[model samples]
Target: MAEIIEDFLVKKDQGYYCAYGDFYIDPLYPVQQAVVSHAHGDHASPGHQAIYCTEATAAFMQIRYAKQALSSYQVKDFEQKFHLNGVDILFYPAGHILGSAQILMIYQGVRYLYTGDYKLQEDNTCEPIKIVEADVLITETTFADPNVKHPDPKEEILKLAVASNIMLGCYSLGKAQRITALLNQYLPEKEILVHHSMLAFHRIYDKFNEVPMKYELYNRKSMKGDEKNKVYLIPPLTFNSYRRAKNVLRVFASGWARLQASNDLSLYLSDHVDWEDILTFVKQVKPRAIWTLHGDGRQLHAHLSDDLIIRDIFTQTYRPDFC
Candidate 1:
């Protein structure tokens, strides 16, 4: 069991540990020291003794856990090399959501890149992704299957422009703001009725200029045909409860459309690298070894030669991406 762990990171009872840095990476439970990758619920939780992450990620956490506060935190600017203990650390743009980052840790002359929930595609709602070179690459293979392909967001958002009204189901934090910004860019003429759950995140993104677009709050009960030609950005959880009107098209924005058929019209939008982009990223990063996290990596194994070392953490505990 000990031999199965990555050299740079040990799989501990609490989380992925780095003895050199004396900290955990995305710990499942709060710990004394943490090197957080982002503010998504699963990755960033309250009560950590201390955290090192991007400035935006810290701010988002304050909002996410409004009533609570972490013991302490240090903000790491993108691409700025910093030292924690004897280890060198750097954070890079991930393009998945506001303040999403890929962390690079260098110790003992070896470099390891941990991509904490990333997408290579362009997103106006957050900083664009930047490729990093390292000896070992830890990737999120959420859509690693050969068949998974995400349609261009602009093309999918354009479909809403032609519709009289849209009940768009998406993750409240990342997906909602992403689609909102896309609409602001391509369908600026149309009004967006955003759910209350997603409004705070939109404001947070706007506060950082991560999302410069504008939208209105949604009041589903009071909505009439008066709010025509609008897109109501609601939480994916509420997709079933959303009542459809004659002109309103009920749609779910997700990568699930690529893998399976859905009862509602699927937008096929995702804040994750598709199969082609995954292959492209691997080639560009050019790591000696690859560690897969958050999703299956069978697609990578099938294409990459047998000489490379590839470990999929999902083989232990597969879970959904916390958007």
Candidate 2:
């Protein structure tokens, strides 16, 4: 068990506590004590006994997991240290979403930082990412491959606007908000058209007082015969299946858009950091060991110097007990 703690586990006592970004989950540890990094579906699990997250995260969680009983979670503010199991833990903004956070834990003299899903680029919808030093850093390598580099957001948005009259397809949640905000800043008078899913998320953003624009939401029914020059925000699944109206152009916004399959005319606007940004962050933090998760970690590992030990952990299929 002790060896496992050194090799795979963070700490071993009652059960297992693994830190990823702002959330901590331990199968052996009480489920009631999990810490959520944000309200994103991939990061925040529904029906947990109790959760700790930022206030904005809590509000979004309420809207998302409304069926679950209220008061089952606790909201933790930024930079506040909370102690658990003799370890000091703190949450810092990750700049991926409105309430996203990176979890930093200090046990005895060792410090470990878990970056859930983060973006170093400036986004108008959320706070900017911050740099913190730690002994060990767990980060995401979503866009870590050497070939993946993104254009500046402002430049990309301008190109996207000039390339097509109709902007189609984007994640309705954080990504959509970001793209919309960019459009609002650049094309203030243009009316933006959004699908139902995007509308729902926009409503949530409005509820939280983070909406940067005054725009109208439109469904498929409402959009019929509406030929106004506007940006249409739709989920990827919907965009791929639905036939676009004649003269409508489609562009996919994601970190993976750099691939040959994803190069469309609109733009590849990503919410995640590019390869250069990842390396820059690693150098800034200078962690003793780097743990990479969630997408192409091996590619990232190969680029870094040998001095920084890179460990790729596959959380999707990872089970700590077997180790």
Candidate 3:
């Protein structure tokens, strides 16, 4: 049976270090060489000497970090093979966000796939997941418990149909664009208003979409009852900062129950794969061994049979510094 090559990628104080490639995958702090999996702040950091990622990821990182963006970017297309420190590396679409990627490293004939925040659910705002087989699968277990099953996103989006005036709390980057597209598609009657902070991200995503999304910038004038149905999409922080708003239904879209409890309506929407999706992906990829990060993996270990090797990388010792 295949096992984790400890020396290949060791858990360092900063992040996951690959001695073979001389790089860190989604490092928490600045490093000499970072192979960033996506544009998410937690995964992508500033002050890296050099970054290797997809073109879209580079764009998003630049927009997010501004002046702090990396000095040099070795941007590449998906599925294109590039040699880095004697290892063959390829970026596969992770389906988590617009520029999210699953980094694949092939060294000495053994393949290792690092899945950085992936989902099997259909999302029109970004590229869908492209599953590839590997000897070792290092995946994010954000929702890998047997009890958590994410509801259909389309169905969850429809929950706002009844509320004429709605305030949606979403993450500014990926979640904002997704909710905007869903509102435009399923709830066409609603006038989508995007927060100014998220407008740049929406505009960036628009460049990659076949048809541009429809949204107006959020303003106090629009919040007035001039429009019949209005949905204002704001980031979670902004949503919570408000003390109260008149005649508006407050809702936050997330898989976590705590966020849903704070809002007037529950919208169980998430970009991460649920337990069933994880199981389906595991079956499709047919990995020899599995290593999980990002969340608790005790349930996954207990549910899967002994034939499958399951290891949790985010235990006490190997935990990431960012968290």
In model 2, where is the ten-residue run with the lowest total lDDT? 1-10
Tell me the alpha-carbon RMSD of every candidate: 4.6, 4.5, 2.8
- Candidate 1 lDDT by residue in tens digits, 85-160: 8989999998888898998988877788888888988887789999988888888888888888788888877877
Q: Candidate 2, residues 1-323: lDDT per residue as tens digits?
A: 01112333343332225543223442333354677777777666666677777888877778777875678777788899987667688889898988889888876577878788889888878878888998778887888888888878888777655434465678777888888888888877556878776776776666665454666777654445555556777787887776545556667776564422643564778878888999898988878788776677887777664677777653344444422
| Candidate number that wins on TM-score, 1 or 3 | 3
Ranking by TM-score: 3, 1, 2
Q: Which residues of candidate 2, in runs, are more than 4 Å off? A: 1-16, 19-30, 162-167, 207-211, 220-222, 258-264, 314-323
Q: Can you give the lDDT of residue 55 in candidate 3?
A: 84
* Candidate 3: clashing pairs of residues: none
| lDDT assessment of candidate 1 | 0.78
What does the lDDT come to for candidate 3? 0.86
In order, the Cα lDDT scores of the candidates are: 0.78, 0.70, 0.86
TM-score result, candidate 3 = 0.94
Local accuracy of candidate 3 as per-residue lDDT tens digits, 138-256: 98899988889999998999998985688888999899999989989998888899999999999999998897999999887988865658888998789998748878889998999
Window of ten residues with lowest summed lDDT in model 3:
314-323
> Model 3, which residues run further than 4 Å from truth?
1-4, 69-71, 314-323
Residue 276 accuracy (lDDT) in model 1: 93
